[model samples]
Target: MIRRWIAVAVALSLVGCGEDPPASPGRFGEVTSAVVLVNPVINQGSTTSVATGGERSGVEFQAEDLTVATDSTGMALVEDLPTGTVTLDFDPGTYSFQVVREKELYDVVLAYRDGTVQPLFPPVRYPLGGEVVEVEPGESIAEAAASDDTIVLLKEGTYPGNLELRAEGVLIFGAWSPTRGPLSVIEGNVTVLGGGNRMRGVKVTGRLTSNANTFSAAFSDIASATITGNGVTLLRNRFTAGQATVPSSNAVLVDNTGIP
Candidate 1:
């Protein structure tokens, strides 16, 4: 799937955070090269620019999707996040951000004059601008998995046995926390029959199988998994079933354990 990511370029004055103090935390750096959420409240797709420092600063990143994933649901991210590092120069402030694609909280860092980067933790949510579909506890993930161009979030709870995902262009996510609150578990086999299926932040205690469809997962746990198709990408996940050779394709495996 094509990765659609949104980014921001903001001057110091127009940036502010809700539900927290708005003052510039402290002035410590000449340039802060960090990722930030600038003017997240505004819809940037139609608005090309905003006034900053008495000048019209054109919007650098355009939001591709308007539906944003709210809360920690496994809902699809509003935009395709660009991978790798982004550099932003800014003055010291109490800033916070969130990455939509990665579905994780964001941190605002301070850059010192001596080139030291200090990240301010306690991250907050920044909407990627998309429609959010809420999945309550004990809800079936089938509809969310079958949808396209929507964000699906499963509240912290255990789901029923096994899930069959045959849809294309959908993301069903679970709560992502180190504490693992709302610990989510799929008790049965997860079968993917379509292409561009992505899974993250959940534990599949049963077997994971896929046809010759394109699949991707990150930071997930799989018991014993098998694949019959190509275009499978697994990153930073653990598979107890170890590795198996597909008849016709090779998997794009990165930072995954017990998979060859």
Candidate 2:
């Protein structure tokens, strides 16, 4: 009920000046007495074999009775919040978060909706002997994969075109923003024909199709995924399209949120 009023007040603020000034959230208390900064982020390690990640951009949530939104840097400043034990409610459709009090401040941590923090798992690191291939946005991921390198690192940017991996045992790691979502986004479809491949911290805006080669993805986002390989694994992933096809007898899915 409180959030609904806040929404209506916010809507009124956007109207042209002919309307009366909207009521402030400060009606609940002194809006200037206590100002707090909130950082809403997606913390990694909520799923299997995922890394401790970074902050998101442009997120919105509620601080006490007032609705606040974060900027592109994923930080918001809220004034007039009651000093003690303020309750925060996040949008349940997008993420699961919990508020942990420290001194007079609060730390928002991502977890299950039940307030259960899942155990953290160390992310996959680059191998010692394998060649490391680095690619910037607009560069060819396919070319990097063609090098048959052990690791392909995508810097923070968008890559265009489809990606097909035929190399065996390759690991693709992308620059990721935990709370803001994927930093490295692939604009086209991804086809994996290679065996024993792993991908982490990336977002594929297009569909993903994998053949008989075993594949695993952690902490990533895909529009849709189709796996025909045995022993495939998907952990802590978000499928925006809510479509996934995996052989139940051979695939493992854990702690993922999206359309079923």
Candidate 3:
């Protein structure tokens, strides 16, 4: 409900004025705060530049440093912020997200209530080694995949949006290497329409589906999977919330956690 109102107010501000104010999350309170969610489907660990109003008549203002936390939901929160418009400046790079595999980071803002704000950030993946294309911040994942064959070096950054794998035999490997690389979170649901794809070292917070496609994965974290593809092997991956929803298929699952 609070988020809805905030959205409404932002919208009205946008409508009233020709453009957004220089500083946004505009129109936020003395107690105004925010919750940032990384859409794991699109990010490596994300960092935001934060500014807030001062304690006095909303005239004085100060910048606040944000702290990242990895709770059960792995969300971050800011509290006791002054009621003032806030704007986030995103810097693209790798971050030590404290997860097995690095996930991409996406930032979201909401009304700061009595200190209960939650948002999810996300996007990654894999092979021994292959032809590589290193991605940058706010680039197109699908475009990179479509052009680059064999492997994609998804360096620490946020993709513009979700990804759909159209190339067969392409291995989407997140980060620079296994031992190295920051958080790589995908922001949207993913589907591999082609076959013989491989992945590792990426965190996806949305549903994953493979239709009649065969793929292999390891060290990847998936929210959920619906695999109709045969000859699939999932090894040492993390599945949150539930297990893979598969019908009849030759699927191999080994050392996967969080499946009931």
Tens-place lDDT per residue, model 2, 1-260, is: 01111222322332432432112211111122221222323222222332323333544556667787655643455554443455445554233223221111121333222322332322122232345555678888877777443566666778876889888877776766635666788998999988888777788999989975558776688998787777676655788887867555555455466633
- Clashes (backbone N, CA, C under 3 Å), per candidate, total 19, 2, 54
| Two-way TM-score contest, 1 vs 2, winner | 2
* Structural similarity to truth (TM-score) of each candidate: 0.50, 0.52, 0.46
> lDDT per model, in order?
0.43, 0.54, 0.45
Q: Pick the candidate with the highest lDDT.
A: 2
Residue-by-residue lDDT tens digits, candidate 3, 1-260: 00111322433443464642212111121123343422222111112112221111111112255534322332244444333333332222222211121111112422121222222212111212333444555676676667324555454555544678888877665542234322466777888888887665666778878874558665577888886667675644677867667534355444356553
Q: How close is candidate 3 to the true structure, as a TM-score?
A: 0.46
lDDT of residue 33 for candidate 3: 39
* Cα error, candidate 1, residue 234 (Å): 0.2
The number of residue pairs in model 2 that clash at the backbone is 2
Task: List residue ranges in candidate 2 displaced over 4 A.
Answer: 1-126
Which pairs of residues collide in candidate 2?
42-179, 56-180
- Superposition-based RMSD of candidate 2 using all C-alpha atoms, in angstroms: 16.5
Residue 16 CA displacement from its true place in model 2, Å: 54
